[model samples]
Target chain A: MAMYVVGHKIPDSDSICGALAIAYLKNQIGEEAIPTRLGDVSPETQFILDKFGFTAPELKMSYAGEEVYIVDHTEKTQAPDDIDEATVVGVVDHHKLGDLTTSTPLECWIRPVGCSNTIVKMMYDFYNVDIPPAYAGIMMCAILSDTVIFKSPTCTTADIKCVEALAEIAGIEDYKALGMEMFKVKSAVQGTPTRDLVMRDFKDFDMHGNLVGIGQLEVIDLSVFDEIKADLAADIIKLKEEGKRHSVMLLLTDIMKEGSLMLIASDNETIIADAYGVTVENNEVWLDGVLSRKKQVVPPLQDGFANA
Target chain B: MAMYVVGHKIPDSDSICGALAIAYLKNQIGEEAIPTRLGDVSPETQFILDKFGFTAPELKMSYAGEEVYIVDHTEKTQAPDDIDEATVVGVVDHHKLGDLTTSTPLECWIRPVGCSNTIVKMMYDFYNVDIPPAYAGIMMCAILSDTVIFKSPTCTTADIKCVEALAEIAGIEDYKALGMEMFKVKSAVQGTPTRDLVMRDFKDFDMHGNLVGIGQLEVIDLSVFDEIKADLAADIIKLKEEGKRHSVMLLLTDIMKEGSLMLIASDNETIIADAYGVTVENNEVWLDGVLSRKKQVVPPLQDGFANA
Candidate 1:
């Protein structure tokens, strides 16, 4: 049977590229695997795929009775809805270990790094399989996107080294220029729907019995979002009601400014206020020098809900 | 602060040697680590360590404020009593993913091989660190013990290849002879107490809200346990009552005959009887070709209880 390689929902560049690269590696090692995604590709990811000469992965929402190899994330909330019916054969991730359990022994390769593509690069080296140049190009772009162009605090030396090596393999002389070009595509929000922007990188987390939805939108400049912050906040309120979530937040992150403007829509704002030790005004707050959500935003919210 | 490298309770050869080898590798990579154990070293493990000129690791039962790297097991039932209070920085194992969650990104290396020592050997290769002769000898012995000298169904080609590589490093030409020697040490039960024999290699599992304790003793001849079978049953009953467990079982496995004589002491015999589809007689039943407690035993019982 062909195994499916997949990543979390609200697929980001790293998740999509990691799935594609891992499926390619597994096939090279004599296993038939197909890359899959839980959601639609965002504009940034679409740009990288077109630039690197690759198509988006097949959209697969359910995995009943199928075999899968999970990548990028381990949380049950981020998995397919019927994931309990599928068998997880392996996992390659770069996050805190979440509440995912497997019945049989599995191949798990998890590490503390900025990007899942770094671990995928390590897997290629482990198997001594040469990656094709196009795969290397997308993987490099994934690292650059995930680490916010090496500005996120989660960026480690291993991630930096992997991006450089991947760039060399892809025959790209100026990878930084390529990263800036990709972020420029990400910052385009002129005609896109507000709800689409809010759901661009959204995920639901079960924090102490409360379901919280968090999203991020990275751009080169913060001024572009000054016109639609009210619309984003209203859309988040609708999202919270529809999903029956305790809170919904969207982060408008300016990569060049190295900060995030957080828009909050919640049942009670005290949780977020007390968690970050900041007061919220007008349903929004400016978080200085906060770029990485996995490292900076989620942990304190988890702690806050846990204590509450 | 020095990180502690430890294994699960009931310190078997694989668990003990894996802790030592991983701690050594971490130290070689410039991290300060100390090997620790949750229980006393069994006679078979002691023999292997003494032969390899290494001492037993320090006994540590709690890890309240310390950082740890778990080996051999991932289940919460097998972890330290205060595992929730400690920080798990990494895990290296060859078992099913268990219910252990961490709040921080960790280094996890889990594979579906026969033994944890095989994974440790791969880790040694991963870091390009040379293994000491003593470590190699003990690691080879651990592989032999866990895989039952390649007779176990769980033994894979990777495990055999690792043992061969480790044996060459340990300067052992006839590794099979050394394996037989280790089993001989494991088969000795003339003067050992019934409780000690039962707890030699025991672990507890949560089977659908029922805590089940299972132990295994591998020997060359099953007849050696004929005289103490009744005493072993009584001890298991006592263990079940004392620990408030739903059931306790002991497998007297004859390695040469390639079968096991399972003794059951349970709150309800139908659970085990229906699991393996066998009719129990006098609290014991002979199982043909059941050398692996992990591959052949646990999965069926877990499924049986889940269905029941």
Candidate 2:
């Protein structure tokens, strides 16, 4: 008689929305489906929640002792305090598996399509739940976040199905038009705080076969970043002092131009220096002509990490 | 020869990724697509970029005084600093239209389903671009954000199509499995700042007749919000003084038991007295048997706003 709370990691619209949707579904099936969070949500996540009128989820450090299920994120369900030694009764999600260890078997619904939200949307479609406007907004937010409104390469047929269904439910006059407006509105971020800036744009990478973290900050007008660059550099220095494997890389990129001005701070200064052939000034330095960090910086970083 | 840079108001993954995808697509079709941001990204966004080894985006205040063929945002091509005056070359999006004004018609692909990223993915699918692993991860992230991983009603058939296509192109062994992992990453404020606690989970509301703003902050663990109830009250009081609205209410909800602790900060304090027969205490209060803000609190707020 234990309820399971679950969600995705480093959550965005999909993980948060999927958790809520599935929790609602589990409630219908007579199970206490607790929608849980593993970390703080991104700015886009608030948009998703507000769109759905879903009260943002309560945050938890991990899902170790509680009876937890997985969603959106892959396998980091190793919380020993909350979800300890318990079996997950039901599970549904879409993402690559990370670090998960379970002692018991459970009902896992993992689809290889677009989004896990799509699966839950299908469930709602099958059950004929009245698609609320707020929920519709949340669904659309997830689609936008996950697929970048279908620009990224991880979308699928099932994801598209859910989008259409949600659109129909939303009674959208013209989705394509709205999509642009929404995106345009989302793109404008004039005076957000430094902390918010840090959390908005990020990515993951494999550093010499070990998981590493890299982040980006796009300042359309480098003036905004220039004002805060010193503070940002200080934060990176602190992170480096903590001896973490992650690298804090900032790209003063000009959207109107093809090149970027890169700023990097890492513990292994030599590692970064060797990779980019750049010098560090006061534990901070900038790189120019950087457009594709994945295609460029990461490769070299990985090479350095591997060589080390 | 000039490229237009656009970002959403809150700038989610879609806002940034869509900008990039649309820009890339436009460039393919021989147009300059600039990835612009209204403001900077948050730490979470940086994480996504870091994972993908990318930058946030160039900051662009507005689309005013711009001349470019917009894509993936709106169909109204002549949105002069509004959703109405921009020139749209192509409208490949997945959002419902709202108060959108179009001076002239354009070739708009306003699909009622799927994420805009999926539309961009379709184009990429056509081109058969080799999606890097991290970029693949971002595409997945966008899908998760947009569809809530398929939980919300805004999803569509097109979203699913993109998801399947992306999973293949991204080389995901099991898309669904990965989704579970991603979704399991929880998003909540455990040690967040008082301001963040109040604002992070907030959602803006368009009061029935008035279109100002209303936000809700759910405190799943009532104790946490209660700890800073006084400070939160002060913040709300400040909000009332600064905002141009009659009522701005905050619902400190506990989702586990479907109950709420309400906090009202507005000019019309009697609304709380009239609606729930509760006296306002230093602009802080609570409501019994109140679970859903939309279901309960908003109606009273709407009535209060309307009558006022």
Best candidate according to lDDT: 1
Q: For model 1, how does the per-residue alpha-carbon lDDT over B85-107 read when each residue is reduced to its tens digit?
A: 78899999988888888767899
CAPRI-style docking class of model 1 based on DockQ: high
DockQ of 1: 0.81
Error of 2 at A276 (Å): 11
Question: Could you give candidate 2's per-residue lDDT for residues A127-202 as a string of tens digits?
Answer: 5666666667677667755554554345676666677778877776566555555544444555766646654554
Any runs in candidate 2 off by more than 4 Å, and if so which?
A2-4, A62-64, A75-86, A89-93, A111-114, A122-133, A156-158, A176-191, A200-211, A216-226, A250-263, A267-308, B1-308
| Most TM-score-accurate candidate | 1
RMSD of 1: 1.6
Q: In candidate 1, what are the lDDT values of residues A1-308, reduced to their tens digit?
A: 99999999999998899999999999999999999999999999999999999999999998989999999888999999888778899999988888888777899999999999999999999999998999999999999999988999999999999999999999999999999999999999878899999999998888878999999999999888878888899999999999999999999999988999999999989999999999899988999999988888998998788779
Model 2 chain A weakest 10-residue run by lDDT: A96-105
Q: Give per-model TM-scores.
A: 0.97, 0.41
For every candidate, how close is chain A to the native chain A in TM-score?
A: 0.99, 0.69
Fnat scores for every prediction: 0.83, 0.00
